[model samples]
Target chain A: MGVASTALPRGQTVPLALRWRRLGRRLGFLCGLAVLLSPALFVFLWMLSLSLKPDVENTAFPPVFIPTSPTLDNFREVFATSPFALYGRNSFVVATAATLLSLLVGVPAGYGIAKAKAHGLAFVVLVSRMTPGLSYLIPWFMLFRALGLHNTLWALIITHLVIGLPITIWVMMGFFEDLHPELEEAALVDGGGIWAAFRDVALPLARPGMVVAAILAFIFSWNNFVFAVVLAGPDTRTLPVAVFNVLTFEQLAWGKLAAAALVVTLPVLLLTVLVQRQIVAGMTTGGMKG
Target chain B: MGMTLTSAARHPGRPARRAVASYRRRDKYIRFALPALLVVAAVIVFPWLYTLYMSVQEWQVGSDRVFVGLDNYANLLRDARFHAAVGRTLVYTVLAVTLPVVLGTVAAVFFHRDFPWRGFFRGIFVLPMMATPVAIALVWTMMFHPQLGVLNYLLSLVGLPPSLWVYAPDTVIPALVLVETWQWTPLVMLIVLGGLAAMPTEPLESAVVDGASPWRVLRDITLPLTLPFIMVAVVLRAIDALKAFDTIFAITQGGPGTASETINIYLYLQAFSFFRIGHASAVVVVFFLLIVALAVGLLLVRQRTKWA
Candidate 1:
């Protein structure tokens, strides 16, 4: 209807054929979106159905798209037998630690890289990020083990840093580079020290960007599958690892598995919803550089 | 933030303390930047160097190592399984990249236009991208169950035949691709949506005003301008697809008889499962080179197109 309406702006004078064309165009556009989004949407709904269905219903042929007599057994099972609460606590601690550590170290580095125009350092950081996690797996595992850090939250926290720090640097790099230097210069002219100037002028302006970076980093650390699987201890399994343990220990219990999976995804999903705009910005801006 | 940057030297009183002040400032920059650099070095540098060293030695878990030169590389090249995996990896990456790019662009375009419940739909659209990948894998694993899965149930309603998806060797990569496409297409859409939002409106308006069909206006004006952003998406997806492991690991573990084993799976199997540490180091180095090469090539293309 967009171009069609442009061609025939006046509704009263528009020909019937033109009106039909506009309707057809609008229908076609809506259909494209429908076809594109249906699979993603359907899978989610199907997961919901799976989670709510009975164990017998979960395996029935012509699988129930919507549960007729949904039960809370799966949800009950998810919390009843497993150490889900412990896993959730562990994930929170590790993800928060990673985010705070990344911000502590990466923000200053980002500002330095921006001001110094340190392309080489930036390249080094980006390449570190680009390298597959597998490449770092064995060595980090052995090194931490050698240092008596294996199976400790410390080890997981350190490994998670590899994922979170680069993200902070990446998002903050964009923010710092775009920040006007004049603000910092004005503070310096007022006889402030460099740190004072940064704290007063630059840091406040970059707060929004820092929040975006932190949220992105937090989500990534929370969702990271490999690092936790390899580094975390028997007592310190993250949610992904704990959920995986459910899949294996509980066997194919699809209903319970669905419930477990949903539990694992809920926190991250809520965070994403809260900061959808920032997540999109962080991803696109960080993605563009790589 | 190791060795990030130095602070500026403070003005010395009567110019007598200039040297010490400047030195301290330089030291401060070194100090501020050092922590990040140290972490990178400890995490990436030390491990990578160890991997390179391990690649040349016949090392195993809890065993003495001996120098083996490039024999592991040579042996891997001669292995048919490795070659097949390389081929499969390329094929998977191609499908994974192409589908998301095209479908995502279309979805992006559709969302760009004024529509009913656009915000609500967009919120739904981005959910897939934000959900944990491990969770997505588990959910898809359930849905991919042949007789009991909801996907086939839906297909049965539409009169389409149900087929073995990840359970069959031949269809395993395709099934894996389906999961990947579902998970990643939203990301591509978000990127393209960002691009579309940023695009100038004048060219599109003028094209429609000049009596061009809507299709022509899209093809000639909209698509070309968004090509750069699309290319960026391509580059990101390509790298991601090349290294994809979690879903494959969780669902199939490169199974249905090695049908879906990408480089990552193979490396994991060699290193941790089989304990062929030396051989796995060789695989690591080779994979690292592949990533670097693709990244450089894509960056060059991006630069040539002025997408920077």
Candidate 2:
């Protein structure tokens, strides 16, 4: 139908011009998106090629754009030679723990701040986030050393909380503002306390927003290298820091590094796809109304 | 303002009662705000203050702390490496901010209208932002590998010699910027897309009816409407870009002759690798000032634009 509408619009000159204009706009939009997306697509396809190629073929001069002898050797190596699974498990524990902790502190905090109309407190949190990580890194470095907490997972989780908590709280503040206070008030009127009102009414309704916040926070904590790098002993190193070790130790294993990179990203990719809607909704919600 | 709020809330006959009530409320706020404020101050403010104090000292690994006031800052001022990091950081920030904003705005506009495969396309485009930075850096490192990497492979296909990418001092910052822009452009796109999605359709419809070209309408209508959202994205991303450490650490560890060592990486090296805690603290203090200046400047610009 679209093609027919654009095809000369038989016996109607005016309609034809309008139809052509619309067609032009559609074509332009698609082309623009394709151009914008090329960099992402290019890198993705390249990684796929490297992941599938065998080790020798990976280094073939005029390097193999496609695997002629595709194998799982690199993935197998990533698993067998290193503690890839252990690192992945550690990442999961740290990320999940950090996200849950942030939500615990941040959700109530976000609610209290928003309900109380504490814009000053909100601004204070923003300023805390605005302070570069290094400012805290130095002092915390000293404090953790003095406490003998250096190179411990506890240090990693706590330091990451500082980074992830504020962002989660701030984002939740926006989510909380969009919610109707009437629901919580209704719960309170039924003799529910503040905590109960949040638990049964606000929390249930805020599931989508919470999911978005949790996923983003988890992804960030999972990917955080600085805290993990500084605080994690070799026994506790997370995947990101582990992958970084590849650069220093394995100068020749490009394929293995690529495979390791893919392994690290697989979980976040799945989560991003799953929560894509909530995230995009959360981001664009305010602007569309204003 | 406090007095006015209390007066407005009070019955005319109860003015004195309201004043005392409001004073109690103010007292309550001061009380409730104290603990949170203390946590923030200890976690944030004390570190910064310590950084300032340590910056002036000449302490190093196992060395006596010499009270060298202003020496670290002075040394930084004369240091060529410090100058290079500052220059590279500014360059990276500008490109990373601008390219993403412009491209993201365009994407937002194009995707604003309904179309076939719209949902699929939207999800696919945001995939890069979902992919962690280390993953993106690793993938790009492969693509940029001088030998046996896809980027070089493609270059060979085009009859061009392969480049060293991160290893080449001249190319390191640009290479880092490329990876960053790749990872973050989707973020800018998502924010702009939100802004575009939120924009009212009436003004745009009227502009079209009045025979404004799409470009003119975009400039006068859509651009102005989305300026706040765009500013928010730019400022927030500038903060992150200024503190960029992850990908650089993964790919180069700020090496290949200090080509990619940002201020954040420099601070890390000083405090941890080199154990120049005092000097590193000074660098952190300086870096904080730069970030504060950028944030304050942006906020002021935003306020002025709003008021105007």
Candidate 3:
């Protein structure tokens, strides 16, 4: 009671019925998020501006927040000079394939662990997830080279699955544990086998879990850089690696790089924003009850 | 086929049932596990074992591996760069974790109740985490461009001269830190927001009734209750920060000097670029041990808390 009431910001001098403080509270909250969010927003605005400005204005002494004359030339240059479209396609395909593969492996793994009540296996999986990607990259580089799969799209997809699968399994394990077992049991009692019970009963209930897993899996795989950097060849290079390649080719092409960055960032950014409410709910549920 | 026939002949119905049941279990195990085991073995388990083997050998590109146990580990122990990398890694982790928690929690508390544009703000702030870090790094690198960079452009507004950002070794780590914080603070914000939303409001209400101030309530009540979630954020961020490479690689490439080089970057260069495979493996082994120790420490703390 003390804590809740205290949080409401009341003063003895001001009457309890005064509504000004509530208005102040709302303004203060908005202000707080503004401060918290400005750094990121500034980045987006700056990049957007950079993408528009001509190369000369890009280096103007007082950096222009608004391009005096915005141009689509940088966008045109990106397409004309680089394999940007191909890279986008590659990233999309690999991310999608990896997400699907992770779901296939992860759902069952999560289910088994949840059913068996194996915290040890869960911990083991988390440890694997925690292991730095680079720690495994070098050896895998050698292994993939030996297998002649290095520099292939297959390698990028598989490597991303390493990132995607564990999170899917971990998050879904927490989710599955929260689900009622009675549904599956009822299906089994109705002459369904374990597979059929899981497919028909548990799977439907697990839709939200699947959505959360798929979203997070896609995001991680799509943004993955280290794996693609090491494994992808010229033909298989993903967007991030492709952008990095451009940076190397023309050092400090600020205008072009910003344009390219924004182009690549827009799709995922929009998707993340659209699903953020569900994502937050998923995260909260997983964290609180896992 | 032979076993089934033999079982049918030996014990009729019961033996056949037993044979089939065991076979089914075996088949399930083999079918479900073999492919997974093979993938994991080939990808994870094998590399780890191979890295251990590599660490004890005098191996380099195009050279036959020769056994030289402990030398690589000894070399890493004596290497000043390794020591510096360890220090940088810790500093990066501490700054990255602490700043986000404090700032994120404060924002979360302020925004705990309903407010206009809350969803929009939350969604936009989380944009950095969703986009590729490398791409963000690329953009920020340009933003930090000595003359053309927005950072300096802003600094000039405060009557300060333009400063080198990515170009200076001293500023490199801090620059990377800023980028990391921008990207990850939203994540912490989400966690803290969730924690705040879930918090019992009754305590705060009673505190207000007793005429206690907002400051007092936050200090005496809210912080203590949200400590566990904050700790979880710290642990997660620490692990991620320890492995920070992509953004740094994209931005400065551990440059101006090795100022921004974490253990991961050090290992990457030694193993891949220079082909000091043994030394790199040794570095990885040490890193692995450190992470294990941290995980164990967290477990012990969790157990102790439960005990209490």
Candidate 4:
């Protein structure tokens, strides 16, 4: 009876105050989160709103946060005016070819370097990545023209290797280092050659790393501007160049511009959202570990 | 034992042959790495060397090539525009890198705490880093409009006067840096967050148990431990900001009276617009050296502060 009487008042008074404090803290956290995220969210939302709204609403004073009557006319106008489909196809081809080639070559190189501990070779490859795109562009432009490869997808594919190959090598190197050598050694002990060991054991193990490398390479190639701007002709221009052309040729049609911008970014955005964990893992490990 | 004894009696040279075979196998890594190295040599190494060759010769469109040894470098040394571009690049890099590292560290610490839907919020935060730069530039160009843009409207709401975002000569670099900060701060945050996640919890808990304040623990423990990661972010950001082109080219094209022209923009104009190939090659070499030097400097600092 004494214990029950003691517990009753304590629970009644203390629990109420404690719950109120917890509720207040929760509210404070939500507010801080909103404030932190608003800027990043605002830029994207504003672009989305501009793309959906008509021209009149887009340029209105006290800018509209939400579109009153969103329409697809702006998107229609963009597709009608530009060869955006062709540009998209060109980008896809270049990015895909570059990524595949980087994997075919860079994966083995990464494995070799990791196994052999060829730090000098790895550093050389990194320097290639760090070198400015423009440094390679002028010479590549002349060489391609001389070889009649300029204004073709071939040129873009070859040039994009500068971006894709290093990333592939670095990421694959990190992955391969993490893998124990015992499995490959066991395969070798069974009279399998080095190539067989790699193919049978390490390659299968490094598949996820290859995926990460391929995605990063493709995204980078897709986003490339300097090489395309210098080398690409009217027929070979990629999506980024197409977007830039929209601004130069068209007047300040905010809706159309926003529409064009969203179109180019959509694929990468989708990839990022879908594989965010992989991408983050790749970025941190690829960047920091090396 | 009987079969092994008979085989050994029949082939005494087998051991010698195996030694030779194993020796050959030791160089197998070279075979695997050859294709990538050859490709890199053809595409990157050779091209850079060719650029070095071109830097010594004056070549322009519709004109005969002339070898002008050291003339281009000499011109670069005295060129006021080149000097200005270099200065602008350094300033922009500093502004961009410092702001992101600082703001990203804060954001990283904030996100380190447990909150509802933290993963969802983090995904939203990283969207900017993934978006295409040209598209981002276009969107920001519209938003930076002096008269009808929402930014000014938001500013007015806070009882502050509207200012030119990317239009004015003096405001253009800072304005561009703002966008760089917005897009890249998340990268720094992610890197630092990884560092935080990997850090041990024992020290922090003991400090808390010892009645140390949260602020003190953060300053004394968290920041010091995360410094290496922060340095990594700084180096990456600096390198990128020094090479930034797509957004600035799209937004201003180095306009407002050449106030925003960085080294990349200037080099582009020199090589393409003016067709001064040799001069532009010289600029490329200088820009490359600057990057290498900055990287080395930052790496040294990182080495000094590196933790296990």
Q: After superposition, how far is residue B26 of candidate 2 from its true place, in Å?
A: 9.0
Q: Using DockQ, give the best candidate's number.
A: 1
Error of 2 at A48 (Å): 2.2
What are the per-residue Cα lDDT tens digits for candidate 2 across B1-308? 23322443452435476456435544343443344455566666777787888899998978898889998998988878888888888988898888777877777776676778777777777888778788778777767778666776777778998788887998888888888887877777777777776778899777766766657878999899888888888887888789888888788878897888888877788899999988888888888889989988987998987921
TM-score of chain A of 4: 0.93
- Poorly placed runs, candidate 4 (over 4 Å): A1-13, B1-26, B114-116, B304-308
- TM-scores of the candidates are 0.91, 0.87, 0.90, 0.92
Q: What is the C-alpha lDDT of each candidate?
A: 0.82, 0.75, 0.78, 0.86
**Model 1, range B1-308, lDDT digits (tens) per residue?**
11111222232133445445534554455455678998988877999999998898888887898899999899888978888888888899899999999989988887787767766677678888778888889988888888777777878889999978999998899999998998899889888887888889899877766768778877988888888889889988988898898889888989988988888999889888988888999999988888778878987988897865
Q: What is the TM-score of candidate 2?
A: 0.87
Q: What is the DockQ (computed on Cα atoms) for candidate 4?
A: 0.41
lDDT of 1 by residue, A1-45 (tens): 353356564456558877787788778777877787788778777
* Residues A55-105, model 3: lDDT tens digits: 888887776678888999999999899889999999999999999988888
Per-residue lDDT of model 2, residues A1-290, tens digit only: 12222333245568768777778867876677788667777787777778788767777776767788778888899899989898998888888888887787777676666666678788778777677665688788787888898877777777777766776667777777778754554554455566676777777777777877787788778878777777788788999888888756777687787788888887887777776777677545422221
Q: Candidate 4's residue-wise lDDT over A1-290, tens digit each? A: 11112223334567778667667766776787887788888998888899999989988998888999999999999989888999999999999999999999999999988877788889988788678888788889889999999999999999999989999999999998898665665566555688987887889899999999998999989988889999999999999999999988775799999999999998988888788877787778765754
Top model number, TM-score: 4
As a TM-score, model 1 comes out at 0.91
Against the true two-chain complex, what DockQ does each candidate achieve?
0.45, 0.34, 0.38, 0.41
Worst 10 residues of 4 chain B by lDDT: B1-10
Classified by CAPRI criteria, candidate 2 counts as: acceptable
